[model samples]
Target chain A: MLQTPPARPGMREDEVDTPALLIDLDAFEANLDTMTAHLAGTGAKLRAHAKTHKSAVVAHQQIARGAVGQCVQKVAEAEALAWGGVADILVSNQVVGADKLARLAALARITNIAVCADDAGQVAAIEAAARDAGIRLSVLVEIDVGMGRCGVAPGADAVALAHVIAASPHLRFGGLQAYHGRAQHLRRLEERHFAIGAAADSARRTVEMLRQQGLDCPIVGGAGTGTFELEAGSGVYTEIQAGSYCFMDADYARNLGASGKPVAMFRHALFVLSTVISAVRPGIAVLDAGHKAVAIDSGMPLVWQRPDIRYVGASDEHGKLEVPSEAEAPKVGEKLRLVPGHCDPTVDRFDWYVGVRNGRVECLWPIAARGGFY
Target chain B: MLQTPPARPGMREDEVDTPALLIDLDAFEANLDTMTAHLAGTGAKLRAHAKTHKSAVVAHQQIARGAVGQCVQKVAEAEALAWGGVADILVSNQVVGADKLARLAALARITNIAVCADDAGQVAAIEAAARDAGIRLSVLVEIDVGMGRCGVAPGADAVALAHVIAASPHLRFGGLQAYHGRAQHLRRLEERHFAIGAAADSARRTVEMLRQQGLDCPIVGGAGTGTFELEAGSGVYTEIQAGSYCFMDADYARNLGASGKPVAMFRHALFVLSTVISAVRPGIAVLDAGHKAVAIDSGMPLVWQRPDIRYVGASDEHGKLEVPSEAEAPKVGEKLRLVPGHCDPTVDRFDWYVGVRNGRVECLWPIAARGGFY
Candidate 1:
């Protein structure tokens, strides 16, 4: 019942129509290469977070580019990647419910699967599910570095969880998941450096504590698109889990690098192709991409290639563009590309991503991990 | 394959599971009855906005409750309602491309379909589509009623469009669409009153101008969940188009009535059922519902029925809740519901709305119009 997959593969961009999800393949490939080259000789492996791409095609491309594996935040997302033939995956988060845990255990039958646990109860749940399924589950102990959001306390508490994981017959102690979710978008270079510095120290201490307890850390993972360099440079973090680098968003454009320039690791590959529906005022025009078409969590959508036009407001069915003084407003029937403030949630809004290269439709990738909330 | 439907026809709240859409049938009915009662003696009619519900099931309910027709913002939305057996539909916005306009005109073969036009080009396009389909398409002249978003000029410009509509034998004049979208979110009653007052003045002037040329508006539709009362009371707006009354969200709570109290016309029923996936800290817990489950375009989601616990921040896979120092944090596997900031966009995030009434799985309804981005 998908009316017509937004932009089918091999179709031209103009032929694909309006209000479609467009991904610049060249920009996307460049992003993949940039991340791969940066993490080339670094001992840390790149398990590019699939929760960002949510497409098997993208995962396959990343793997071909030399990523060690893929990391997913949900069991359903893992199922998508695994079904797409991703050989290795880490369910970078915990699976709680019996039905979902059973589903996770089933995935191990097909791929090298790993998951994390911050609590003893979750460890026991994973162990029981694995035992019943007659499969060994690779379980990591998540340690809270400084995000204060998810993970066990970074020192002795993390060791205790690691012990619980090792003691389980059906579970093997993986490593530490010390992720500072807040540091990814710290804006200033010094702020991100300080945040990652504290996070690296916390993770180093946790790994050291585990070693003292005779536990070998196999996979110390934690990093995002914003701070992968910081985590990869740290000797303790063996795995870099950056997701949004493939399609950098406006929020990421706010981050500053060491040399004080805005970090430009990735190009703006994703955009919402919208059509001008109404021209109400001299300097105000409304487009079809609105709250439903794009995600505005980080901020309003940026008018791609149109610095003079500002996407000032949005309703359910309309996006209001504020025309700069002395600038000609967009006429009705014109098409515009809107770069979303946040890329992850914005991708979830559409059912398909129209891959456009050189102004022609190259491919249409389904948002397979869409609605993997359960 | 479709995992599940958006909602169920006959199910109680508890049986549906957590984070499902709960339609308070009583409140829903009351809202419809109130609208019907308000427009009973008045010559004006009700064209309930379908952009809010995006479901033909709800559209049918509104039609059964004395509504003359249903109005949707997009052709895809209109098609879903029309396919669901709604006889009369007004696409309250313009359709741009040939594919979409053709789709709009094709619906006329199955139902009484109309659309609004703010420009001559759009009017000509609609006329061409109607002629091609051999159908008489009703066209509304959208006037800039102070919402600087969409519409033609209020005076001669609108009258000129009406004449354009009159010129086409296959097209009929169908009044003015003068929706002030910003006025819907105005927190103060007086502000909304002033906004709608200006809108009504513009519509009235347009109607008078049309009358000078022997044209009478058959309909004047515009109003939203927030400012429906203002437009309904304006004496000029013939049709009250409120959509969110069926599923109120956190944004509507910010709206105040004339008495300065939070508008209590409808109860909050829509929510994202999320599970406590991680308890990383003693006074903090992370839920599975994050940016993907709930939208933050208007603002962050509120913890349903739990004022003490704050939804402090959100990531793609997690919503961080700050538990009160004295309060017990949620354990892993516990479920909580989040009241979304904006229901329409939040609902668009899900493929299905698990409709639960009392308890036990009763029935499921597919979001037939889900991903209708066009």
Candidate 2:
């Protein structure tokens, strides 16, 4: 049910099919190394989020680069990573249903599996599923740090949920999940610093409450690409859940660093390779990649190396580019690379990633957990 | 790899997994019949757009109910539909790359394949590929009927391209491809009427120009769910390429009809079924479905049948809903249905469609062309 790879190893970049996902091997490796080196002595380890890449191959690479484990959003993602030989997997979000909890519990036999919960009913569901599957499950109480999306209230409510998990015979209390999702794209470094500061405070108070109840919070996991440095420096967060740092998206690049410039910690490694399919007009060209190929939830994609050409509009499968009067319009069949506005959903659009280096294909990796959204 | 189905054939709606794509069979059948009956004797035939559903099973159902063929945006879609026994397929957009054109030409062995082009260079590329494949490929001259996308200027430019295709030995001049994509969501009925009126004028003039050049325009194909009535009444568009009418989206629901009310032609049949995973607070609840499960390109998905709850925010795997103070908050594990903002990309997120009727799973259909975006 999957499409074939757009290009094979050693093939030139121009030979790859249009609208295929391309990973710049040099930049990708540099990004991996940069993040690993930055977090070397920070006292916090990387639990690289697989929800961004969804490729077990990428997860394995991160693990080999000193990531403690892979963080996933769904039970199916945990299954995919486990099947691909990932030893430790955490479902960073809540797993609510019986079918999903049963699947998560089943993974415990092959690897270390952990999940998050913000409610007592969710704890009961996970405990029941673990008991029925005859396995022990690690459960984390997700506290509402600052996102106000998911998770229990910061101090007392989170402690209450942790006590429920600790009392269950088949469930083990596994610290806190305090991800501030909205803060990750605050655009200014000061805003992110303040957001993470409050998040860390909430998480710290919750941990103290848990400890007062005779419970130990082993893993205080929270952080993303935009504010990983703040959480890593706080001495509160133990596991960084940074995902998009592996392949910087256009939206993340728009964020300001502490130096008052665009965040430059990670290079743009992921791109949607497209072709100019129509250029009949003088100042207009159309690309084959649109909403289905690259996501627009954040914004329109940026033309990788062509500042003269702007992606002005998009339909279902066509992206319209406005060419500058000073620059010549791109001809038909001309190839271009687009830095996606958002990485996660754009990565979900493809089955394989054409890894390229120096204009040649270096590797082709299958997106094993591409659409594992259940 | 694809994830497991959210529900089996015998499961109830509540028993289905969270974040599953669902098709209400009753509403879906009504939508299908409404479109079929609306275009029964309107002179223009229905060429259902497969880009919306991406399921050959749904395509066969559309064909069985009197659709002329299936319209796709990618060659991979044509391959999947052809493999699933769809005989007639039209790639309703421009296909430029040599690899994609070759694949589209190869599918002519089992299906009647046609594609669109707006440039002389694209015509030469398609001619070369079809010549190499030893097949007579049908080529349509796409005219830019005010969409400002991938098409040539109306009269002389379209005639020139049609001549280029007709002059090629391996290519047959199909007709004119005139689609006003932007006009589909104009919100006001008069705006759409004016847009379609201008599009039909451009198409009519292009057809006349082609006739002057001794070419007969057999298939002047254009029109979507939003403005199919105007194009069908225009006497120029011979085929109606309405895709989203079978599974109306929330964006389309916002469009106004001639009577100054929400367009009531089609019922909302497609939905993303989600479970409340977090509800610890007074009015805020979080759902399991987020950007990965539903596309937010057009807008946020609406909570079906819950006017008091508004989907205010979304992260990768969580949707934050704001409930009214007068209404009770949704409890954990409570199932809810969401009408996706955009039907095409949202349908592209899932692997299977859980067809439900009377609160029970009626059938499970694999989305045969879900990720066929190559």
> Which is the leading candidate under lDDT?
2
- Fnat for model 1 comes to 0.64
- Residue range A329-350, candidate 1, lDDT tens digits: 7888888999989888888777
B42-129, model 2: which lDDT tens digit per residue?
8999999999998889999999999989999998889889999999999998888778888999999999999999878789999999
lDDT (C-alpha) at residue B296 in model 1? 76
Model 2, DockQ value? 0.79
- The TM-scores of all predictions, comma-separated, are 0.96, 0.98
* Residues A1-374 of candidate 2: C-alpha lDDT, one tens digit per residue: 77778889999999998789999989999999999999989999999999999988999899999999999998888988999999999999988888888889999999999999987888888999999999999999888887777788888878888889999999999999999988999999999999999999998888888888899999999999999989999999999999999999999999998889998999999999999888877898989898889988899999998988899887778898999899878888899999999999999889999999999999999999898877
Weakest lDDT window of 10 consecutive positions for candidate 1 chain A: A1-10
- Candidate 1 wrongly placed segments (more than 4 Å): A1-3, B5-19, B24-27, B37-39
What TM-score does model 2 score on chain A? 0.99
Q: Interface-residue RMSD per candidate?
A: 2.1, 1.1
Fnat values, one per model, are 0.64, 0.81
For each candidate, what's the DockQ?
0.60, 0.79
Fraction of native Cα-Cα interface contacts (under 8 Å, chains A and B) also present in model 2: 0.81
Candidate 1 lDDT by residue in tens digits, B217-278: 98889988888766777788888888887778899889988788998877776777778888
* Model 1 RMSD vs true structure: 2.1
